[model samples]
Target: MNASEANFDGIVGPTHNYGGLSEGNLASTRNEGQASSPRQAALEGFAKMKSLADRGLIQGVMPPQERPFLPQLRAMGFTGSDSEVLQSAAREAPRFLKLVSSSSHMWAANAAMVSPSADTADGRVHFTPANLLTTPHRGIEGPQTQRALSRIFADESRFAVHDTLPMQPMFADEGAANHVRLCEAHGDAGVELLVWGREGLGAYEGRFPARQTLESCEAIVRRHGLSARRTVLAQQARQAIEAGAFHNDVVCVGTRQALFYHEQAFEQTARVQDAVRDAADGLFDPVFVEVPASAVSLNDAITSYLFNSQLLEIPGEDRLVLLAPEETRENAATRAYCEALIASNGPIGAVEFADVRQSMRNGGGPACLRLRVVLTDAEHAAVLPSCLMSDELYARLCQWAETHYRDRLDPADLADPQLMTEAHTALDALTGILGLGGDFYAFQRV
Candidate 1:
């Protein structure tokens, strides 16, 4: 049976703004107080999805969660109407309000870790929404993420959606952004690479926090019933973390048999390679493309997001293509390296840049914007039809964003009670667009 990889990109939410919530993410912190263009941001994301779909690739859309998460505010003992609650929170605790209103969910790569039916023991796709316990803003996304995933992959006979791990420091999981799967083809049994930032409750002496834990990786593997023989665990380099490579995907990405990564990406690079070779023994010969620090320093890689790219094995193409961010081309060092790479006649034959500067400013790039899920024809068909990207959907989404999103949003704008109304109204309309039903949002359930 042949299967293909689908990129399910989260649509940029209506409340897109800069709050500097992620402590370890340098870009987010650096651009904290800057105003954002929510309308342009959403349009850029939609354009990227449409481009991929036009290129004969499978692209899907994940609608954003309702913003100004009033339920969470109400839970915090803020008693009043929705507008009054917003006013009270703004007057009393603006930081808490910003945390709940964050549009970080646009980065779908951190949404979940997916195991294709080809790799799972039960022959069904499995999804485990990340606990994201390292940050208060992201930690609140699990419940909504689970609900959204469940709605999209509703066929229990073909898809198994599991609950998130317990929310504890010992089980901090950051989803597919910290995971990679490599094989000869999408349908083949693959080698699963589970990357962790630290061991359970262990001390990390780096300047930045290590989000993924070793115990969480093991728990996900066990819950997904992955083959132990084909699973390899590796720790992320503390140095990379200190340099602001918050997720493994920031410094590494894999597709088919090729792994493109910065040399400093793993603590024990040789051991990781050897384990991968052993696991992929009869399956496929792993191709490792290591970029030395001398060529492109860790700082340059993080700034340009060179490795935070979607490495795609496009249909009818003999070699892979790197869907990189436009920032990679703008940076002198990374640009020169990309030119040399294309001329080197390597497995990665071409490098294309996407203009997702809105997302790039906040520490997410092309890879960060989407979650990759490999599915066979039947499994693909099992997915909700409206959720899949199409020419019609793209046009509709563009118009929808123009109609609902604000042209410019300052951090202070979050305090306005009308913004909350606008966000909920947009989300309510989006549920209809995605066919997710009226009660998809918490407000609707109430």
Candidate 2:
């Protein structure tokens, strides 16, 4: 029952633009109202998947959700046909239209929380889509994410897809962005580390909103039936949150038994490490690779998204590789830190930079654009073949993006009825490409 982790990355949608709907994301806020190239964005995302697949790592794809989310507009009392709804919303409430038309789902790390078969009680891979209740634009993603996950991981005996937790502020879940698992091997029973920003009912006076709640983490643990002895819950540093580390992943990431993070990633850093070590007592000794604040300040780390890189166990590599965003390479401090880190003979043997500037502009890095699901051979075989990446699939996806996606899209373009039509048409064809049924989207449902 040897297992390996698969990264399912969300395809950048046709409506990709800088909406700046995310409050605490500095990049998103900074790049607000800028024109975006949907064609380039989608292609860049595909290149990342192709690169990983070329390295013999399993790469999967998740289709983007339907944008302009017409149903939401209709629910908000915007009457008439789809085109009319777009026009009316544009004329009356332009800001609301931009929020609903956001393509932020391209960051799939917030798609769901997954537990490998070795860790779950039933010996099955489990998924619970995040409610994403912190932001209105992202909150609309739960239903579609649930549908997509259920469809891709449809086999009953091998996988279990649970409904999202109650969509309440009390149960504000941001999925894997605030979660990590450390293990000796991909197949081994791992210690799950769930990070929380604030208590559900507690007040936080931080400059930014605290997304993941302690109660939400507990709920997922209960739903997945994870062993209490093998779980560790830690609070995200308040300083880090206010510093624009909106999600814990912004300041930390873990793979296998190595936890690479910033110094201020957690409130009680030593205790969190001790708890993780205790949970992993007999299994494996956890490696803590802490990047001191002096070496790479919290602002530098967040700005460069150095910690948001993916730590991977490549096939031939003895040590893990850090797949970071191009921003890390561009930033002087993070670049020096990476050079020092790889040369130090540590668990991270190599550092690779990926050009995901389109996503980066919207505050997502290499790690944010993916959802990791560890699966045994049997569970892997059970996944929908079309959802997995192949050379042929990549080619087809590239052609699809070039043919369907716009070369450029601006905030003003969101008001055009044409953009909505183009989005629906592209997504409709994409359903066939991904083997998602025709009724996969809200517009297609009718």
Candidate 3:
């Protein structure tokens, strides 16, 4: 199989703001009501994508969803014109309006769970959008996300873009944010590690809500037709979830063969490791970079997002590189651990820090900004060329952000009709630049 791994990052939308809509995310709740810079956010995200592309990694872009979601409000029983919909929602249901207007889709990691061609039954890469039933705001993204994924993966011969997993709470899927894939190379048949936050059908819940469910993980495995031998399921530790590790990507990130994670990432770390080794018995030996709690306390790990960084084998170097947020390098404890990690004779040889403060303020880190998809040669070619990162495309996108995005956005601005008009106009222009058809978005279809 001529396969390659592509990281598709969501473009920060024009209406990007600090809504504090995610209940389990510390940063989101802590930064509520703060003004946001959409231009800066998009620029910073673009820089991350460009850096990966510069290192020879294949990078793609997912367009942002429409914001100030009047369509959703109308569906929720708001009447009259779009302006009335916004005003009535603002006047009668302000909190709900704020939640629905959130631009949380920028965290593309939650977009879907993907199984590569090497791990699929029909040799087609499979995509199942996470139902996101735990969050009412995010739950609305399912249909649109499917539309976008279907458009991007239009070639059914090479891809299988399935609908979002069932919308019920029992099958609440959080997509790749809670999943990990490890293999010798992007083309190899890798081990798929499904991390469920809690038992889907279990009774009672934790202090902080668990977003992914065990039943959802099993459903993904069966639907993807992943080999039972190469698949392993693990539950996220209750402590991690309580500590604001809402998604597995917040506590661990696996790339190639290295499972870079914190000591408290899973409920039974040793058992998970053993299962990984057993699954990869014939494929290859797995590299485990387990960061002990004493080295980086659970608090420090969550605070600095040390484990949430992207751990990948540098395209040509073969040595692993950790692309983390500036916070990881700025936090004294996490920075120290990062230095020690690279200094040690381990698989990780380099650490790169980026200024993604805008996204971080909204509870997104480097790894949170991407959805990794391993695609074969033909499958890769089918991706929209304009969405791929290059010097030219990066420059264009930077210009697009500067030209269309706002300098500062506040929660109150969600009610502004002018803002909605501007967002629609900007997204309309974006379709042309991304080579997405005019009808790629819900609004565009209207």
Candidate 4:
């Protein structure tokens, strides 16, 4: 198999899924006498647009609504219109989807390569719109991701692509134990690679310790062996703000952190020069150069702090778009971010910033919205200390785990720790899945 087929590792990320969903409700609930800030006003405006869209006033311009979700919106006292305003809004709106339930948000994968799964008997992948988002979510189970997975692993020669869905229910900090259970299962399966990181925390229902997450990852790595670089522990650059190293922000190749602080962008260039001396690991890429052309502002610094970090690889050309934004407004930031991408001179694909905007509405940017799942070459590479003994052992484990755990731990069971545990116990059936001799974490639904 070619590199693409052997390792179909790609960045398929979503924007942070915060604030946008309830902006309309938030705007309507407030007293008319209350004052609002520009950020609040912008949110209110966005809320209004979404509100108008919901009432059919903005129709195609807004995200596609689900039949069941509509009643919930109406019950919430959101009475609007179904007039012709929708056509106008739709016309003026961007062609891409926004932060909505159905049609509004989008999912994108890195464009570097598309691969096929080697484990499959046949080497073909196909997808339809219906199954696209079906992989997983907090409440909804859309088929979009399923379709993507299907297409990615259509044939045996393809690298099996899987969707890493966030364990739902929303929590600022802890996540349901079930989500952790799912992580265990996917890792042991040795087929489906899961993505995760600090960004994934926002999507989970409850909060858990970062150590808990790291430990969980350690569990997977110990059992199945990590396939790709999967960790959320890096520090990214920001102009003046103290870096958010707690969230795994790290300096990456294309971007740079300011060595010295200055109001003027030109003065900042000198710091970039000073910092370049320690350029050991591809750290001096253009994105990291704190050039004088644009000094990172407070908000811009925050934007950069959350995004353009070591965890993600934004092309230099596309990187400029995010770096050039002056206004921190959600809409403006989204516009500039997308524009930079559209204007890129690289081989990147289309990125509808609406999805990102919607994600931000929830709380995180693009980087905060994804998880990392490393794909390794050995099934049991983490064990055995070498790759040779893993192949036979891994195959044996797969068969045992499949028959024993398949019935108990369905994907939906990832929500229940009880069930997840049951699933994990059965995982020994597939010892061949990995060569690792360490203890395994199974998927027992709670």
Per-residue CA lDDT of model 2 for 1-446, tens digit only, reads 59999999999988899988899999999999999999999999999999999999999999999998989999899999889998999999988898898888999999999999899999988899999989999999999999999999999898899999998888999999999999999999999999999999888777899999999999999999899999999999999999999999999999998999999999989999999999999999999999999999999999999988998999999999999999999999999999999999779999999999999999999999999999898888999999999999999999999998999997899998888888989999999999999899988979
Compute each candidate's TM-score over C-alphas.
Answer: 0.99, 0.99, 0.98, 0.30
lDDT string for model 3 (172-211, tens) is 9888999999998788898999998878778846779999
Candidate 3's TM-score reads: 0.98
How do the candidates rank by lDDT, highest first? 2, 1, 3, 4
Instruction: Write model 4 residue lDDT over 1-446, tens digit each, in one string.
Output: 22111111111111111212322122112222222121231232233223223322211111111211222233434344422222222334311111121212222211111211121233322111111121112123233334333332333232333332233312111111101111111212112221123232343222222211322333333332333332111212222223221122211112122121223212134443333332322322222222221433334434433232212123333222232111233434434544454465532233323232332332333333222222233321221232121334324433443344322112122223343233334333222243322232211111
Question: What value of lDDT does candidate 1 attain over all alpha carbons?
Answer: 0.94
Q: Report the CA-based lDDT of candidate 3 relative to the real structure.
A: 0.89
The weakest ten consecutive residues by lDDT in model 3 span 310-319
Prediction 4 global C-alpha lDDT: 0.25
lDDT of the candidates, in the order given: 0.94, 0.94, 0.89, 0.25
Please identify model 4 stretches exceeding 4 Å from their true place: 1-144, 162-212, 219-298, 303-446
Compared with the true structure, the alpha-carbon lDDT of candidate 2 equals 0.94
For residue 406, give model 3's deviation from the true position in Å. Answer: 0.6
RMSD of each: 0.7, 0.7, 1.0, 19.0
Model 3: number of clashes? Answer: 0
Ten-residue region with minimum lDDT total, candidate 2: 199-208
User: Where is model 3 more than 4 Å wrong at Cα?
Assistant: none
